[model samples]
Target: MKNTFNIHEVSNLLDVSIPKLLLWEKKNKLVPTEKDTNGINIYLKNQLVDFPIAKDVFESKWDEEIKIKPLGSYNSIELFAGAGGMALGFEKAGIHHVLLNEIDKFSCSTLRKNRPEWNVIEDDIKNLDFKKYANKVEIVTGGFPCQSFSAAGKKLGFEDTRGTLFFEFARCIKEVQPKIFVGENVKGLFHHDKGRTLQVIKDTIHELGYTLIEPRVLKAMYYKVPQKRERLFLIGIRNDLAEKNNDFKFPAPYKKVLTLTDAFKKGDLFDNDVPESIGDMYPARKKEILDFVPQGGYWKDLPDDLQREFMQRSYFLGGGKTGLARRLSMTAPSLTLVCSPSMKQTERCHPLETRPLTIRESARIQTFPDEWEFVGPKSQAYKQIGNAVPVNLAWSVARSIIDYLNKINVDNRKNTKTILQSESV
Candidate 1:
């Protein structure tokens, strides 16, 4: 592809809001080459191509060749490592997994089965001591569950949070003191307990002497995953490290969105068709009802009589309630995969099939390699995949984090040299 396009042309092509575009540029999320003599921002065709959304611009061609930088040799430790989704992404991003901790036997088995070299610590976080990792690992990451505090008492502090998994996460951070740490959770975390839950998390991180980035809800579609998952990312840099520089940036979104067709077919993300695997079956009546829904269609697509019958009282409800009796679309990203795709509130019927997505299909939508297998019963497999951070999305984020850390190391070396030269003088 030719490598230059002006801002206006790029804007029109990408369909992004002008203000949001400017914000992206200013925040250094996507940088333009230079301005023309007329003072209009002139972006190189390469710049437009490099834009996160540019993946869509060259979808057919680039999708086949999109490459990810391999994880280098830097070491990391993971907490709450469910089936190693984030671990695999970070591994792909080039970080070496020094150790991983998870309490679930099935998840632990999944990790060990996939990465025998990894030191899988299979036990509760509270039983482990993280002090051994102090000054040893470069990063610590976790996806601690969110829990509400008793508001009838004093403002929630570290002690008040003791019984929750998040507290264990905090304790590990306090003990390990890695140069940087990452926390991931559901997007609903932002509004949990009217925002106080998030506030407490921030305060806890600050108390542990880290500089917290303003957390963001990164959409999976923006990162090339064929599922519409949203994750809240919490990044913290040790206060001492942040004092040295402030140019960290998040990963750029992929240019193109992926669809179910891109996921199951031979494509950049996978080499061949998804592997055949065991999957959940719908009841006979449920199957009959879902059969009426068209590809990319939902309950509303059913004949009015059937809709009224299936929806029953919910039919009279005020909102789209679209997720109910929903079938997926091949063209659009799949709805967020839940532990149970057949649940009343979160149906994820296949675009064409009458039943819910198969376990392999769920894995593909989350960007797992075709060879990766889940080590559990089918239902447990669904749960593991549903709870995972999309591997590609995590890879994108990990790449940005690595880039930031490398920059920090370089700046530190430069500063050290300057100090030594000054002293000699």
Candidate 2:
């Protein structure tokens, strides 16, 4: 890959906006190298690499050899497995799914329709007892929704969260006692309830005999997903092994960012162009109105009167409602996906087309393979895609877990052999 880039090129490469780049430039953090013949400023790769965050910036070229799958026999049990996003990532990482639990019937159908061999358990997580799986799988994972607790007397234990789904997640961890468990949720959970919720989660995991690592918000763009979605992952290593190993590092970020163009076209990310599929559409009036909104423009781009008509009372409100009538740019990563792209507040207008993203397009943004079919109505399909942890992001995290589990297996073998030798003597 070239070691130099122009200002706009750097902005696209780093997922940083032009204004932010200008600010960095003013701060002497992002300096330019020599200029090209057209007088456009060129930035050497070394210049951006000086910043800690952008240090790994490089062009993304997919290599079949760099793909990491499971190193050995590792099994996992998943909860709240909506549409199989996280599970599919682990599947690519080489972890076999012994059983997957999902309460949504449509999501469960989607999972089974795609992977019939999987044991898809469709029931509320609270109804199921995962105790039977104790020692059965090396890992347990879930993307549980966050909920507030009563803040009843400091050290939050498992029972204190009884009424919440997070409690169910903790209960599963306690019962199954896997070597490690992964919990994922939206980034807001880290600060939900003014941080009490996250503190409670930490305390509860400790009470269940697991050591919680500092929660990390992983960016999807850095992990091969062509969207700027961010997910927080909570990793817990069972106390016994945690004390022995003591460290769990996250996977390294990829050097390059993946853009929507990489996602939709026949390129490094996919063998063929994105397949056409059904998606929701705006009303006739909306279609006519959206037709006037230029590519990369949003509701704010509309004429003054139309803006007021489109945004209603929100037109008079303060902060920029940037998502309104927003059109995506192909050169950059897509914005975080909402459940329904055509929703009034979150209009994801296609870069060239005036329509919302199609089902397959959205799935591609979420990093699902083209063959992975989604079931149910278009609305349900959208919800499933929106709710999923981007598969590539999950796969990135899973690689670290696989590395740790492989180490634990090696240690276990040594311990077993030593015990046998001692008994024989």
Candidate 3:
């Protein structure tokens, strides 16, 4: 999904200075894929994939790495904890998990197998009562799946979304009323139902007496994630807490971007090169057509007749189905990973190999530590990794949350001292 653009457009699009763009070109960091009639450099989409920020393009940056440690004894509860991506990130950021709830047995097994110490509760969120943790847990977070909520009338509120998983997410917030809550979902939720879905969610959070921070789509690529994955993040502070401290800052961006090499090879992100694991195989016919599709090339790279033969009825289709028989480029960041790597609509063929990416390779793209073992069948494992928040992305956000909470804690201690002095006087 890369596109061609001029230097000036690329500079503006990436927020990099024109001089820097030229410097990159000079160093061969970016080479022109094509030259226009006027001899202006026309950059390919792949050239920009591992360096793009504020957008879908995958990129990386190196800033002062946050030295994460417990600000204090902070406790958190996670819901819909799929493969412990966000939970593990928060754990690294120094927050202790009181309990993590997930409905899927396979995912729960994965969580337990990896971290036997974690208190993982395998159950439906609707069946859980979070009231016991009210005013106890400092934070609550979830990557709650988005489900359509039908409106019987114009007054769409919490009750209107009763059966959806997001309702359970909100219900927990309403029950536990944690000091802070973070929710994540796919970026499409922003425009789902013409934006009405998010509006209803906002309204429900407000109804629970929490001050909502204007939701922002956090690109995983911008936060040390190697793939082009974007997650929409929603954070809320309890009304009282927000009133006391209205300044809650988010994490800062990295100065240098990470590349696919940083992910699979022995680099800053990992200790050693990615270990080979079992992966799905391509059918003989599919392999033959894909053999011609060069690295970074998709179905469009096939010969005209071969394309027609492979596409079948869809051979006459107008738009380019770019994902079919795709081969990834080692130099460029991987595309947004899908649950199934071999699907015709979203093929993620290995950069050099003829088959799809392995489970370890997929996990590497997700920024999960090499040691984290995913339980269950390979298919289920792929689905969980594909559906996770990038671990590094969550860690960056967690550091910000910890910093905010640290300030609040200090202020509370000072206030307590002042009140004590007054009473003594």
Candidate 4:
């Protein structure tokens, strides 16, 4: 078997485009071990060890499912629970849900339709009180939108975040006092507000009596999802629990980086071909222009005149504009999905067909089960699916958190036993 990878192979392995690989080389982020006779970059497996995703791909643990049972009846209350991606994953990992709050009626209905037994609350998070669930639930999780806080020269505190959704998330933590909390956000949050926003979040976590784990941005592809979506996850353990135990690690990546074929066709990720369903369609002019783009090709692939016709003013713009008039490749993972597939700035045309991906197809790419139907109009459904965290990715992270909670459970039991023995003595 070939142990070294050429530039093209490395591109496929990393889900990064060839240009991006070259860019990494230019920035000294990725160094090639050697060059082929044709002067193409060739990298040994060990040379890619610095990238966690590359390391996982080289030595995958995908053969085994991450199976972990909840040590106890661990209950969680999820806020901003749009369409239940994380909730479902947490449930699959054996965490029970006490409540799920979402502001969107369509999303709330989708959650209720799938799991009628769940306490799906369709209300503004600000209107709901989490104090009732204090001491009742072990975890509080939310995918809060990142919003900036008004600040002078002074350092921002928990109260300074009051106007943003993150404040609501922190309010729940303060009220519920869960043993652990998880916050999910777009990867951009890492650098938002020139890093000041993240600093405030870190300060708030400390104020709320929890120890925030060094946050990490997890790629969906590494976690068994067939989409190149990236999400930043923040895990915080209550101060008391943090002191009791110190070992906590993120979930390991899968062995194989799944592709569009794994998502749409019968394979390890799914049992059958993606079922047909309604999806958005491109206009005649848009469709005709995109027809010329080849598989995995974007606007640059179009003829000079046609590229000018399709791109108009954007044609003169400086950026690569890679997403415009782009077609997915059957062999690689799909690009991160946007709210609508037909948008010119980020077109998501089907691999073989000229149309946009159907409702079910989009769900599969996000690792949603076939039967896990989205209950709304095509546009609303697309929005729900596009905005969701990949279900498989959530499941992987949830398993790790559950493992940590289990360890804490054991420590608590040991401490109790010791105290009882001291009383008897």
Which structure among the candidates has the greatest TM-score? 2
Span of ten consecutive residues with least summed lDDT in model 1? 61-70
For model 2, the superposed segments whose C-alpha errors exceed 4 Å read 26-31, 34-41, 58-71, 151-155, 416-425
**lDDT (CA) per prediction:** 0.82, 0.85, 0.83, 0.89
Q: In candidate 1, which residue ranges exceed 4 Å CA deviation?
A: 1-72, 151-156, 423-425
Query: What would the per-residue lDDT of candidate 1 be over residues 1-425, giving only the tens digit for each residue?
Result: 45665665565446453567789998997677888888777777555555545655555332322353433357898999998889999988788988899999999999989899999999988899989889888899999998886641466567667778888998988888888899999999998988888878887888889999889998887787987788999999999999887677777766556678888888856889877888888999889988999876678889999899899998998688878899887766788899886798899998878888998999999998877888988878899999999999988889878877887777878999999999999
Sort order, lDDT high to low: 4, 2, 3, 1
lDDT of 3 by residue, 95-118 (tens): 999999999999999999999999
- Total clashes for model 3: 6
Q: Which candidate should be chosen as best, given lDDT against the real structure?
A: 4
Clashes of 2: 1
Estimate the TM-score for candidate 3: 0.86
Write candidate 2's Cα lDDT for 213-239 as tens digits: 888998888887888899899999999
Query: How well is each residue in 5-52 modelled by candidate 4, as lDDT tens digits?
Result: 888667867777878899999998887988999999999887776777
Flag regions of model 3 displaced more than 4 Å.
1-65
For model 2, where is the 10-residue window of minimal lDDT?
57-66
The candidate, 3 or 4, that scores higher on TM-score is 4
Regions of model 4 farther than 4 Å from truth: 1-9, 19-52, 61-65, 152-155, 422-425
